[model samples]
Target: MLGANASKNSTLTLVFLAALKGVVGFYSGSSVLIADAVHTSLDIFASFAVWVGLKLSLKDSAEKFPYGYYKADNLVSLFVSIIILFSGVELVREALLNITNPVGMKLQGIALGTAVFSVITMYGLSKYKARVGRLIDSQALIADAIHSYTDVFSSLIVVITIVGSMLGIKWLDSVGVLVISLMIFKLGTGIARDSVLTLMDAWLDKDSITRIRQNVGSIQGVKTVGEIRLRKSGLVVFGEIEIEIEGDTNLKRVDMLSEEIEKIVKNEVKNLEHLVVNAKPGKMSVMKIAVPVLMQEGLHSKVSGHFGRAPYFIFIELEDGKIKSWDISENPASDLEKKRGMKTTEFLKNRGVNVLIVGEIGEGPFHMLRDSFVKMLQMPEVVEDVEKVVEKVSELSTLTAPTE
Candidate 1:
């Protein structure tokens, strides 16, 4: 959306300036000014190319283009590059012909004013487009910006040639055209190179990859990170990660760990989306543990003192010494009701909760919970924090050992 808007704005500015320059250049009989005006005219077409690219690129993924239509932008950028290259070659050919015929020019004040205006206007538009391109990471916008900026340099040369015409330098005007044509040709090649690189699916920024690795690796039960694959969907990047788990864990535990890692990575990495995660576990089964909590803080959420009366439960599905998917669910049984403790115990068992960590519990509910294979642990005195509670759970697994 932003790219299309910027391109439209560029087109408006170029149209106005090119018209003004054309009238002045034709009347003043300055060939260099005329060529510069032609350059500005071609810019309108280039800006339109960029706008077309951005529009087509906005299409969503379909059966045909499962990856969406991001390549439309790149394809258009390459097309514009070809246009610029051919335009430069033609301009240079015409300039050589114009140079051979060297016509005298009158010092039209309007021509000088128009040249100055073009330089200033193009300079401002170039800056605007460049800033927008950087903000959105739109390669097409950046390429267009470079094209506009090069026009500013060419306009300055046109101004110089106009000054020379006033001082009896007849051939200097054609020389200006010669220089502008060569510079335009050079810029065209550069833009084409960048566009081709994007079409080839070049690697993304290194910092983004690093963030994905660090964030995913930090998730509990992710023993090591491997084979992080990335692809760009316009400015956004999607990744597929392969992770190895530390101990023998069931598929259920591995699945939870994958979801947990995806959440963590999405939270940490900017403009990154994880499409898939694969976890391979070592030789150990994870113990499903539940910790009663007063509330969920997302990251630093603490455990609660009361087992059945807590407002929420911080459930940890642990594999080996690591925690995966520390989920939080509201404790409906915590509400005042008859046999709420028994209700809590029943709730824990039905939900596959194997272990409960509590600061306090009643004998009736405690005994009932154990009958369902749901073990109980006294919450460590130092386990007031999330990290400490995780440590306590890790300790619980070692103490009780794995049953499955």
Candidate 2:
């Protein structure tokens, strides 16, 4: 609403300036001033078009246009570009004709004053529009602001042309018009390129996608971040992402995880209007198992009865029902008297341990590991050797079976 109102007010101001310049240009016979008036008149139409585009873009999604009317802003920008291009071509033709048949103009004081006023007014208006456009992230309004800035330059040229005519340099007026026409062409081409790219549904920049991926991967349940697809509609962005999760994850947890990912991405990327999270099962070709042991011995260490108080943890990597590798490390949290089990659970999780073989576990750690999607297997008896534990895990069920 603020953006639309700003554009509306600016259009009104342009209308006044255009009328003032037109009246004085004809009275003083200043061709450059008349060309500037034409440009300002087109600015009025462009500002109004921007205002309308902002209003239409704010419309909610409907049955007919499920993606909403956000593209209206881009369409308006493209239309404004075409108008500017047309005006530039016309001004160029007029400038060429004037250059061939140079006419001296009677430089009136009112014409010079009007050109000066336009220069100051357009400079201020361009700054105002640019501030508002950035605040609202409106492309149409920003393009309109650029249009206003061009007017400032063109009006300056008009001022120069009027002063040159006062100094008896009549040909400078035609050259000034030619310069403004070229500037209009440059502005139109830039706006047209940007608007057309947006209309073509160009993807978001790489930095934004990378930031989103890093944020999503930080979520606990996400195993891998997949393709991130994002597109912009005016100031808003829409996208979907694919994330790989545990195969045994429940539907309720999946929903929660999806919501978490969406929240993170929204916070990471500005103007993200909508995001869809697609969760899929990750490949389970290998299993990582953690076993609490009495000592930091290889496969010869005896499995400890108490999980949290154990001095060492044996990490085993099993691939395709065969033991691939194993490592043993001292449990740093075993010396802690309070919340040791919970800390141990966190330690194992950070190591990417998906399965825990235990003789006994405290209630806190049991629930925490379970919630973290770690498969807990009960050790029937105190196992003396770590190798026997691997055989036992393989015999009970397939390594890929979901935790009960």
Candidate 3:
């Protein structure tokens, strides 16, 4: 926001000063001074260009420019620099011509006072603009300020040279133009260089990148930082990051982590417009492992007693003295046990234990078992004992169809 304000302020200042200088130079018949005034006036166009660039670059990301137009600011800076460069070259040409062909100046107290006033205003304005540019990190605005500062200093030179001429020191006025031209040329080069760097899409300094990594890596659930990329259009910055996390974590967790990273990056990096995160799951070292004996619960006592082996069927009697269902296969050592790796439904059928007492199960196998009519005790974990689980199922069974 400050960046936008700086551009606005620069545009207004440039136009005002340019017009003032032009009027004064034209009436005084100082071609060199008039040239400088016109040069300053041109800043109005450059300032407007910067304003447009800053505004457009801040637009939200779209399909055409996924990263938004933040680079437009850089282009604005380049244009501003070019404007200064052209002005400098033109001023230098005028100064050389004036040196060759002497022009008499009609110096007066009023003219000197006006020049002094212009000098004061230009310097004061440039100083304020420079400070504002620094505050907002605006290269184009800073360039504009430098342009104003040159005008102020050159105005002073023009005044001093004109006064010296009134005192019969004729060569001093031409010398003043040369001095002013040199200053303008130096500032022009700086603006040009900064603009070029922006156009090239250069990354923020290394320190900034490192700081972003540290801030993002500090987020919870983020194990490491893989890639962090940065780009700028006008006043906006776009960032891309790859974060590392545990493999087993779900999508919801990843989304939360991404939001956190975005917040951190935005807080640390000013003018950040868009942040994109790519989550890379941490690799799992152990793919599969076997565990010791598993416990069984919520089954009939008689059914439990047949765990060793027999005709494969065992009836677990309920607490109400009513038998719920039978487990046809009880022996894990039976010949049918050799086909163990089969799906749960197929394995249970071969075991002859058509009924099962277990906790919640998923749809695929549960529906398969229902089709077999292998009456199941869909027990809730609230049941303390295995028998209780079976009883709950038996209690609900009459309301539903029985399995074959």
Candidate 4:
């Protein structure tokens, strides 16, 4: 985008230069010099077209153009080239006719001086434009740079013609015009070809594709870069890529993969815009393991036991071999005593303790604990025997909860 703006500025500057040249050329009465001035003047229009193209290209995607209006930039560039080509051809034809029949038009010293001035000014602008174009990957700026380069060539030829005419070879003036015209025509063709390719939605270079494939495939859990499709609309490189990975992967893992691929493409490639990542499962079967959670209540410990406290926290191991704490609590404790019980579970959960073993909990507390899917080990005192209670609670039947 910065490149586009800079290109617009450069074109505007060229337009001012052309206007100044045209005004001076008209009063100077040098037909050959005036034609060059007119060509430079058209550059102003070309620059305006480029500005419009750049503005449209930067538009966000919409229903009218789902990929945005980037193609407009190409159209503007193509139009500019055509204008330049015609201008050059016309100037050359006129110069040829003038040389065939001597005309009574006096070459003005100011015309030669203007041509020299234009060369110096446009040469700097062309270099600056090309530098910015390369930095921003802007095709319009590049095209403008090409146009400005032609301006330099034309100016130099005009200056040489004026010098030659003063040295008694009047025909050299006509020859200079023809040379500058040919140079303009050649540049116009190159710009036209480049613009046409861009408008045609040409794919990015092979090197870019290779880099994309390598970068995406290098991501963790990405088995291979299945396919990559790219399109350049104006300055943006819109792309869609497929990645193969292990089958039945969870949403979180897939999301991570997508993010990784996007980051790599954006950072590595200039002017990357929209990206679509299609994740495909590999042709291998893999086991789905349940992440384990430890439960406990005060001094009691259970690998998979239920807690009677509400708003309890759960601790689980992450894939990176690090422990993470998750608050499974939905409802805060209704009473002070219940709050204390909740805090106890939190402390234990934070410390990597798993299950809480309790029975006959309050309705709110019980619902909270059960909602987390913790293993509920229920036991009742049998004939006032604490040993029987412990035995019943320790039994594995109907105590363990199913893994998610």
Candidate 5:
């Protein structure tokens, strides 16, 4: 809203000023003022283009444009640059022709006053446009701001021509045209350069890329940030990243890791519209194992007589084959009349259980376990102690081999 209003206000004011310049220049017969008046027409056109682009750019993604219309801002900016460039070329040719054959005129006071008023008005418009442009991160507004600002410089050149004519220097009006033409040309070229680079999908910026890496680098299970890319349009930025995780990690865990990375990066980076995090399988040391037991026994405790009916279970966390930590919690569904096995399997899966060690598991939970990719080791008989059970699980499950 702010950007739209700013563009509208600035363009309208330029239109009014251009009208004043055209009428005044025609009466005063100053080629500089006349060319400047014509140039303001493009300013209005460019401003409208930018306004439409920004409006469309803010729209949501549609089936036809899956990536959204963010590129509209840059595209319009590029088109506006062409408008200014062509206007400048025409202005240069006119200025050269006027210089070759000077058109003398009865100097009118209205022209001088109009030139001064235009300079003041355009300067004000540029400042307003600049404030609104930065506020909303609108590329179109910024480009338009530049165009209006250069018009102020050209207006000042017209003032010089008027003063020179008053001082009886016949050629200064034509000389003013040459300087204004160059100014307009330079402005067009600079804007075009930036628009083309953005359209080409150039790197956003070094600082922004660093911030993205910093956000994703510290996430758990993200072994390495393999690739990070962001493409910016208008105020929005789209990103994609590749992260390395353990090759043995379950699919469910990988999914969780991918979501975590996306969340962290989006929260940290400003205006990141959407992020796609690809979890590349690699090797790492994070692993967990769970065993159902009748009691809360110590690390080397004995296994329970049954799987789902175990009153308590011990969850062991290991890093690089060595025990890191362990916890015991009561199995809430042990006394349930139905679905106890499935419920217990869910409980273990939520606790990051990669492998399950049990004496035996029912068919229903067994299928659920297989679907969740939980490595199950059904010992033929209950083990005498946890040490024996751990040894058997480490050897049987094709995950990490726990060290002695």
Candidate 6:
């Protein structure tokens, strides 16, 4: 709505300026001012096109157009570019004729005043439209803004031409028209290129994709980050991501993980209108199991009764149902005064611990670990030897059910 309003107002302003310049240019025989009037006249149509595009782009999606009418703005911008290029060609012809056959000029004071007024008006209007366009991310309005800015330059040239003609430099008017024509051609091609790219559905830049991947990877239960695709439509961005998870993960857990991923991506990325997350189950070839222990005793450590207060954690790396490697590390958050369970849960997560075996667990840590997708199993009794625990866990058939 803001963009539409800006376009409408600018169109009305252009109508008045075009009329004023056209009348004064003919009376004073200022060819440069007349050419500038033609350019301003074209801007009226360009601004009107922007207004229509912004209005149509806001329509809701229907059966015929599942993606909505967002591309209308790009189409309108392309149309405006064509108008600019056409006007540039016309100006080139007029400049050549004026140069080949110089005409006597009657420089009226009204012509110079009108040209000065146009410069000020167009400069202000250009700034206003550019601000509104950026605020709404409207390409059509931005294109119109560029058009208005070029008018300012053209009008400035008119002022110079009128003053020089009054001082006996009549040929300056022809050269001024030539220069404005070249500038208009350049601006038209640039806008046309951008409009074409957007219409083609170009991918988002690498930095945005990388940031999204990093955010998704930080979430728990995500084993691997797969392909990520994103594209822009008008002012909004749409994305799709593929993620890998444990093969045995339940449907409810998968849904929860998907929701988490969508939430994080939307929060971290700007202007994201929609996201589709694909969570695929992955085969478990290896397992990283963490056991809370009372002390660092290699495979001889005793299981700690309290998860948060455990002095150390023993990590066992198992492959193909066999213990491949084991390591014991002191728990850094064991002696924390507050949030010890939460901190310890984060610590294990950063170490890529997928399974946690404990004799007991506090409610806070239990839920935290569960949300992290860390499989928790309660020991039947206090075990004195970590070696026996490892042997029992290695047997796929004798493993106990996960803790509730």
Q: Candidate 4: give the clashing pairs.
A: 294-354, 294-355, 295-354, 295-355, 296-355, 306-375
lDDT of 4 by residue, 80-121 (tens): 789879878876876787688643335457767777888899
Which regions of candidate 5 are displaced past 4 Å?
105-107, 170-183, 245-270, 280-282, 285-404
Q: In candidate 5, which residue pairs get closer than 3 Å at backbone N, Cα or C atoms, i.e. clash?
A: 247-282, 301-386
- lDDT value, residue 355 of candidate 3: 49
Which order, best to worst by TM-score?
2, 6, 5, 4, 1, 3
The candidate that achieves the highest lDDT relative to the unseen native structure: 2
lDDT of 2 at 225: 97
Model 5 scores a TM of 0.68
For every model shown, what is its TM-score relative to the native structure? 0.64, 0.83, 0.63, 0.66, 0.68, 0.79
Residue range 225-294, candidate 2, lDDT tens digits:
9999888797788889998986456676688897888888788666888888888878768999998898
Q: Which ten-residue region of model 2 has the weakest summed lDDT? A: 395-404
Between candidates 4 and 5, name the one with more favorable TM-score. 5
Using TM-score, give the best candidate's number: 2
**Which portions of model 6 miss their true places by more than 4 Å?**
214-224, 244-270, 281-286, 291-314, 327-352, 357-362, 377-404
Model 3: per-residue Cα lDDT over 1-404, one tens digit each: 66667678877877777777677777876665576567667767877887787787668879999767767777778877777778767766766776677676543555566677778877887888788777766666777778877777667766775686568665665666666777777788877876786577667477888887888777655668998887665656778898777433446566777778888888777767788888876653321101001233224332221221222333343333455443333335333454322344454555444345543344554555544434455335344444554445535332132222
Give the poorly placed runs of model 3, Cα more than 4 Å off: 1-13, 58-69, 131-137, 173-183, 284-404
Query: Model 2: clashing residue pairs?
Result: none
Which has the higher lDDT value, candidate number 2 or candidate number 5? 2
- Per-candidate alpha-carbon RMSD to the true structure: 11.3, 4.1, 14.8, 10.7, 7.6, 4.7
Between candidates 3 and 5, name the one with more favorable lDDT. Answer: 5
Candidate 6, 1-404: lDDT as tens digits: 89889999999999999999888888888766787888888889889988999889889999999988888998998898888788778777866876787665675688889999999999999999999998887878888898888778778777877777678776776677788889999999998988888788767377877887898888767878899987667656678999887534667777888788888877765567888888886766888988888888888888877777899999999888788999998899999999988899888988998777787667777777776677776664745687777777733332233332
Give lDDT per model, in order. Answer: 0.74, 0.82, 0.62, 0.63, 0.76, 0.81
